[model samples]
Target: MNLEVLSQHMNLISLVVLAVVVAIGFIKKINIGFFSIGAAFILGLAGQMSAKDISKGFSSSMFVTLVGVTFFFGMASQNGTLDLFSKKIVALVGKRTYLIPILMFALSAFISAIGPGHIAAGILMTTFAVYLAFELDINPMATALYAKLGANAGCASTLSMTGILAKNLSEPLGYTGFGTHLFLTTLLSGFVFTLILYIYYKGYKVKGDNPLKLSDIPAFNRDQKITVAAIVIMVVACIGFKLDTGLFAFVAAAVLILLGCADEKKAIKSIPWGTLMLICGVGVLVNVIDKLGGITLVSDFLSSHMNQSTAAPIMAATSGILSWVSSTTGVVMPTLYPICDNIVKTFGSNVSYVELISAVTATSFAAAISPLSTGGAIIMSSYSAAKETTTDEMNKMFKTLFLLSVMNVVINVIMAALGVFNLGHLFY
Candidate 1:
């Protein structure tokens, strides 16, 4: 075959194999990364690529960033620091159970924005929020959803894991200085949906909790104090001075371990190794696909179906659908972000790349509440742990959570359509 024909064949081969890999991930028993590596090898062979060509797709930078940040926060999470901090925040509303949901939203947002980002915050906050739901006699799902939303809202900050990853993915695509813009848009979108959830769950009616005394809550111990300080410093360093996030996290985590405040083994184990692997592995596949023209296909498909006015929201809607079964940071962002440049080209000069970026990001995270996603899975497991449940109840909860996820995604898409995500245009 000629070079052009071989290139087309390689693109088709990589795209089809990627589809199979992603479908296999949905099987629940398989990790997609393994298949992705093998698929990349196949593409490498087909395209006359060297082994280095296949392996180069592995993003060591992204891996280190994910590992360092998660390990650092993992130490804090395992040390009871975050838990105690959560309780202290919950104590703010005192018997005003109606306000607990909003409080949880803000608490999660603050925790996430400060450093750990949504993945860590969602796991920690969703569990806490669900427990509070039962304790405060409120809607468990609603509370969990609010906390999840809050986690997502604050996760896009420059200091946080997702924010860093978003920048890493977007910057190479020529979308520089959009991190702060993306952060603001995601934060605002998060609050808008959180308020919708609060009203829907009737936050004004949540009652029947006795006051939690501030004195009854223990003050931060030395280790917890150190950990909190490290987080704050990391935030300032990354945002104000523009230090590397992953390296700073490693320094903070090492200090915590050296001080005997956090267990090294436990913290290491707490990191989501599987998720990290999936991220890097799928990145390999996506990189290969991009090299082979799969991204061109995506751009063509989008251009065929969408216009300038609808382009941003269309991307939002597509991202929302894919995010139900994919990682927003890992799979969705890396794979789809490259299409932004092409999107701008196809839709017209007036298309705001920042808005498109914001819409896709905000909408993808909107679907994080799906039971298939980590946030929803945590809510499910935490609820089951705290209460006696039957199979039917679990099934119902899953469906209800999925529906709520749809609601959240729909709101994000509508906001994107209405130019709400255009808020980022100011900063851009």
Candidate 2:
């Protein structure tokens, strides 16, 4: 075979191997990261990638971010600070138990909008939201969904990773005002989804016979007090001052350890190392795929199939589907947005650059709720950590989250097809 044909075949085989890894993980209930790392080694060797090149695929930044954030929060949980804060929030809501989910949703969105990204926000919010739900006899599944959706809502802000990526990708194509338009689209869709979840979950019917009194809530202990202050500082430093969140979290966690607020061994064990491995291992494999031209192959397929009338929905669906097992920000957006620019060039006025990018942005983020994605993984971990949730219950929750992600993709696809929330014209 010629070099070109060999390259294409290599890319195709690598993709198939990736799908198999995902399937094996799902079926065997194993950590997919181990499978992914194995696949990367095999594929990298087959594709003639050097050892150094293969090592570059591991996303150290992402690994540190996941470890640091989870460790910091784990310390908080161990110190009883998360419980104390949950009680205060619950007490503040009083007898109106229906507002709990909504509050969690809004708080998640606000947290992401300011900084910390969707997965970080989901980790922080879902942990507390699930705990609160269990305590209040609320639907933990509904609360978890709302919290994740809220993170999606605000993850398109200018300061967010998704927003920065979208801007960088679209700006070279003469697309301005991408951040505002994408943020608004995400916000509107998130609000609608939250509303539906609230009504369907019968949140309106939730009422407590006796409201929690502020006076009855126990005062914070010395450890909890220090931990809370550290958390606040971490947020301010990361969000307000634009510090590296993971590094800041690590420093804060170290301080907590030194202060005797958290058990060092337990805190170390609390980090979600499986999730980090899954993400980083997949990152390495995806880098191999890119090097083997898999991304180009997918982009070429999309370019060939796209036309004026079908472009919006096709692009949105393509992004959502691929992002199910990949990083939307790191892989999907970077690969697909350039293809969008190509489409705009090829079709001219027939394809709206703004609408296309907006659809891609919205749909890509909507799929972050998938169980395979980081945000969804965090939610699953949070639910799993709860003493009240059983193994069977966690399995059911996974199915629920997967279905929710599918529904989210369908909704965004429909919205894009119907031009429901396309704010691209404003940018024009």
Candidate 3:
């Protein structure tokens, strides 16, 4: 319990070093690459890792997993598939002001389940909602609110990049099927949350055009049409659920490029390489820090010291906070999963690992809705300033997003408590 004794643990020291590196990375406004690499090297030395092992910390495999997937999302965007999809949705909802938020939820949930990340889904949906606003003749704030709602709903689904917190929760809970369960539970949650939004924002009046007519919409550009087709095929592939989601995205992206929907130049420009690199860097660094600092060892030791029954809430809260700070599920999962696993082992209770994993996954995904949360920040940043609308309208849009996020978190926590989709096992 003493500070001196805790200081001796490699995981503890590694964590301290990681915290410092992250702080510096933020201050510099650069990728966390240096911090990650530094953490990896220091942890390697402290954990008695060899040069080869340390080198593996920056492995291409990790980059392929993160960056490759991201590029594909970018490729899809470049191809105009997203635009076309949004256009079609807008065409369907045209001047039906009340139905906008409802459609936002449905479209976002389905699209994000197969997209690169939840933020991608959020951005696409929000942008589309803006276009819809133009069609409906609504103020920017209402359009922006629907967009924010789409982002939140879409991000909550199983395909969400943010949803990977389940994987981490699985490792700690000793739950091998956590991913499967979390995926299902999240889908249901998405629908429920969407319904809530739809009901809350019902009955706005606006009559301008017919609600349904595909023939009235113009065809997309040739290249854009191709991209749209490719996205559809990729979505089908993902729903078939045969391969790794990341791999699926990578392949889809490559196919889009090969088909001339997005060339190499376009693909490179489309993707968010900065964010991908940052995640990869932080991910490897966090692993190294854990190894060198023996933070896990200390967690294990303390877990051993506590009543197993009482640690569940603490673990859940910790996972939620960590997920919020790190943003990437990849960065947070590896760091937390092992600790959860240790707790499960120490407790030896009837609670399955999947339950623990599901609990954490549900809560962690919910965290993204907070204004300071990663998904929230991304969505807010993607909001283009409205030239036609007043600044007051834009401010109102931001407030709507904040309100939407609070609703999402409240719904998720309530669902978790109600054992909706067996989430109660997280604490029980």
Best by lDDT: 1
Pick by lDDT: 1 or 3, better one: 1
Q: lDDT (CA) for every model shown?
A: 0.84, 0.75, 0.59
Candidate with best TM-score: 1
Please give, for residues 336-377, the per-residue lDDT of candidate 2 as tens digits: 776677677778888887788778878887888888787788
Instruction: Report how far off residue 123 is in candidate 1 (Å).
Output: 1.6
Worst 10 residues of 2 by lDDT: 159-168
Ordered by TM-score, highest first, the candidates read 1, 3, 2
Per-residue lDDT tens digits of candidate 1, residues 1-428? Answer: 58778776776677787777877788764878777888888877787778887788887987898899989999999999999988887787676777787888889999998777898898888888888788767788888888888999999987777787777777677778888888889899889888887777788788877356678999999999998888888888878998888888899898998898998999999998887888788888888888877887888888889888888889999999989987787678877787877788776678878788889888998898889987788889988988889999999999998998899899888888889988735787
TM-score, one value per model: 0.95, 0.74, 0.78
User: What's model 1's overall lDDT?
Assistant: 0.84
User: Which parts of model 3 are misplaced by more than 4 Å?
Assistant: 1-7, 25-29, 55-59, 134-149, 152-177, 190-216, 235-241, 244-255, 293-298, 301-313, 382-384, 387-411, 421-428
Tell how far residue 253 is off in model 2, in angstroms. 2.1
